[model samples]
Target: MRAGTLIATDSGNTLAAVRRCEGSLERMRGLLWRPALVPGQGLLIAPCNSVHTIGMRYAIDVVFLDRDGRVLKVCPALKPLRMAMARGARQVIELAAGEASRLGLLPKRVVRWQETLTA
Candidate 1:
């Protein structure tokens, strides 16, 4: 996964270091066979409306975002084997449990992601 920062455009706050995971293979392999994300780490899956924790070992905070990057919904502390979905969502951000609460991610909050250059 390529790394990046999620920033709240309104408050200018850096939400976390969220890795970008695109393509079918990457999206399908999300959080599976992966270690638990640190407090300030997350995964951003684009063109995703729903997610499942079928093989995930740790809980996660799921944030659904619209095309314009406005938050549409949040499912916090989603445990393993659970599933989450949001209508009208164009992307989803999976964060460490409680990380969304820590960042105060709410509906309508505009969050922008900036990719970090990797050598």
Candidate 2:
């Protein structure tokens, strides 16, 4: 999948170096086998309202977003073997633990993505 930077436009915060997970295969793999997610890194899964961390090796923070890129909810430090769902979320961003707070990705915040030109 192509990568880019996700920013919280409201606070001018750079949320993460994100990879878009749009297709079934990409969404399914959603950080499952990664030993750890580095700071400033995350996965943006579109058209997704629910996520499971059943096999994840580490905790993560989840931000549920609407179609307009507004945050509907923020689930922080979600431990392994758990699931999170937002009723009206159209997409979700999964970040390393505490990355949400650090970036001020709270509910109602707006998120924007800028594509990175890969060499």
Q: Largest lDDT belongs to which candidate?
A: 1
What's the distance in Å from true for residue 50, model 2?
A: 0.4
Best by TM-score: 1
> What lDDT score is found at residue 51 in candidate 2?
95
Q: Distance (Å) between predicted and true CA of 75, model 1?
A: 0.3
lDDT of 1 at 39: 92
Task: List CA RMSD, all candidates.
Answer: 1.1, 1.3
Candidate 2 lDDT tens digits, 1-39: 778999878777666899888689888888898768878
Local distance difference test, each candidate: 0.93, 0.88
Candidate 1 residue runs with Cα over 4 Å from true position: none
lDDT digits (tens) for residues 1-119 of candidate 1: 77899999998988899999968899989889999999999999998999999888889999999999999999999999999999999999999999998998999899999999878
